[model samples]
Target chain A: MQHSDYVELTSTRLNPHVDPALTVWGWEVPVYLFMGGLVAGLLFLYSVVVLLRREERYPTVAKTVPLLATPLLGIGLFFLFLDLEFKAHVFRFYTSFQFYSPMSWGSWILLVVFGVGGVQFLYTLAELEPFRKTAIGKWSVWGLFKKISGNTRRKLAWWTLILGIALGIYTGLLLASLTARPMWNSALVGPMFLISGLSAGTALTMLLARARAERDILVRFDLLLVFMELAVILMWVGAMAHGSEAGLEAAHQILGGAYTAVFWSLVVVAGLIVPAVLEVQSLRGKWPHTVVAPALILVGGLVLRLVMVQAGQSFGYGA
Target chain B: MTRTAHKYGMVVDTIACVGCSACTLACRSENEVPEGLSRRWVNQETRGSFPDLKMKIWSESCQHCENAPCVKNCPTGASFIDDFTGTVQVERDLCTGCKACMASCPYDARYIHPTGYVDKCTLCHHRITGGLETACETVCPTSAIVVGDLNDPGSEISQLLRKRKFEQRRTAAGTRPKFFLLV
Candidate 1:
């Protein structure tokens, strides 16, 4: 018996462009992007708390985030370093910065965050008596260093404030810089990445937060970030759907094409709406599970980058 | 910042292209473009119904744009225009094989090599600098590929372009590409 599944098409044109496919970037890019966004989110959240009120003790929150963030960033950067095909010539990135290249800006920006953020964050930590009594504190002179004053901490907070936002925005700008990919080509990527990072960062902070009050703050803040993320993503998709031929096709890829299932199931349901709803329920005291939203947010964050990177590369203008 | 001395360009007579794969083969052998990846190839656009089919074969390669995205967006100064000829060239040593140029390039002309650096058609820089044409131009059976200086008014490319109605691929990108297809 012959199978009776005949796919009918109104138009079947054999129009092939150069290369006609995208297999250049691999898993490393999405992983790097996720890590970069996560670190940026962590720094930004910590800085925001310090900026809001440097004196108020939010013990289970970002006060100890530096310990996690500094190392998390290092692991993220290690992935990037490993992904470099010619690792020996990585120094060339630092030789001369191109104004036109976001990668150039990113290299310098990552350097500043790693150097200044890492040092100051560790210094901020070592001043605590528990850390001061540790082997790491005794092994290093950084512990002996004077704890920064309120004024200095405030100033450091401001610096991290600016740097953290830049790092958050840079993650999106990295993709947004490529004009060829319709999914990546948008001003919305900036805010989208920033908000998503904040949401993910808040989720992470909530996970680490042992204090009920701290978790409450993180949960509420993450809810706001989730709403903003949802808005930014919708705006991005809507703009693309209305923008150009290539952009429309790209929207289709997510809305109801190759990436349709992932986009809806993972990004929309799992990443955005579900997290927001969970946070909302937790906020209303209807659900005590504060851990669920943040965990889903982290998973969503990874999937967002992965699906976009995959879809954007597949969507081309000329083809 | 110093500018190049001349502007290099290419014009392919698509009406004459036989889709022989000769140019792609010549480019591979001339440039030693590894085993799998190619520096240059032909794109066939087939349209209309069967027996009424219209096919336009475009011999595609690096466009050598005046405002090249690859040149602008490359993190390292690996992908750059040659000062003498104005043809975009790569300094393999400077390339991190980051593939930024590959992603930025709309033409998909750049590729990552096994040596951990990007490689692309230099328009046969060695030969062109020596007052000879590109190997693709030299071996093109129909003389479909013409390479010359676009800046020189007396140049053959400028003269042909001035005489004929030509079109460029993806002009909307605003790259100000040097490749021309005689209409």
Candidate 2:
């Protein structure tokens, strides 16, 4: 058999940030994603608790978690701003709305979240004894909230729920919409991030809830979310495996490539599986309820974003 | 038949290229592209075994696609298609430097300029709009690079593409790139 060996030598003025792979988005992006996902989970869970009329049973979730949404989202936005090369031009995002751009959609969605979430936060604060005595809390806005009917508040809760879901999915869709990067091109990324966000939110709620019943219910919900997240992760990888050449290579990136160990150990096992197992045991009364499970879940959720953002940038069609 | 807008494009005669990188240098000198960054670059590909060999060299840059993903994905209206020339150009003032356009570009043609804006090949819009050839085209020793309005049937680029066999890079990306490489 005759053998034919092929070699190609090419050289160009290399742009380090773009050439072999796009490394433009750094730690700031992942941090922003993690924070955004956390807030999304908090908003979704708070809205659900309100809609179910379970606020009495889950007072901490109803009152405390809603207060954290705006602050956490603010932190996320700050990190996102830091990642911008032209920091002064950040306002340009709001100047014109490009319908096809996910970042545009995200900026707008976040604005709505802040507005509705702000109202929700103020209402929660007005009810609290510490806030009622505060100088700013004595303002007329609390009186305005007082006149808002229960039905109208429920409608507000519905908006919060929808916005929460949108914010969660938007975090993933931001990357998924970019077809240039094969790893993030899958539609499953949206649902995956949403589920993970929900799990993180539930875990945080469990950690803060002083009532035993609240923690018990949240533990079960977090377990279910963990399972859903695992399924979505499988579907995300499976879809990539069965996709085009670039996509298959993208799947390999986390399956056994550079991201494999961190992805499996930090994100899957430590983040999802272990927390799930502990929560199940706690439900069975075989394990003592501790902060370990929820803490693991929060860490896992952060690691998931870090891995996805970094790994997605490590490969592309050009790379 | 009515005359339409000028659809600017480029055709590179790979056969005639000598891998001298004169085009890349000329482009840098003319554009004042910042240090360690370029709007265009040269590629040299060699294939086959020691017994038989084939080499192809060509200058490459942004395709200025009719369906540019950068334009579609830019959160701000910074990256846009020029109406008159039908070329992809950036509005520096509107760019947020979010790097979304860079991530969306399959050609890896865009880079963050030192002035903190995403920049890429404009197809020498500044020169071509004034009825002049691009810096690279003017300096090509072998006359390997041809830039013209593809909408004009008699233009050199259109005529060359019609007469010779050519290939566009990453056509599957659905960018509908105008940069053609003659095989």
Q: What are the runs in model 1 whose C-alpha is more than 4 Å off?
A: A1-20, A54-56, A148-151, B1-3
Q: Write the per-residue lDDT of candidate 1 for residues A204-253, one digit (tens) a residue.
A: 88888887777888888888888888888989999999988878888999
Q: Pick the candidate with the highest TM-score.
A: 2
Tens-digit lDDT track of model 2 for A204-294: 8888988888889899889889999999998889899999988888889888999999999999999989988999999999999999999
Find the candidate with the highest lDDT and give its number.
2
Output the lDDT of residue B73, model 2. Answer: 90
Native-to-model Cα distance after best TM-score fit, residue A230 in candidate 1, in Å: 1.0
Residue A110 in model 2: lDDT: 92
Q: How much of the true A–B contact set does each candidate keep?
A: 0.43, 0.76
The DockQ figures for the candidates are 0.41, 0.68
Task: Considering only chain B, report the TM-score of each candidate against the true chain B.
Answer: 0.95, 0.96
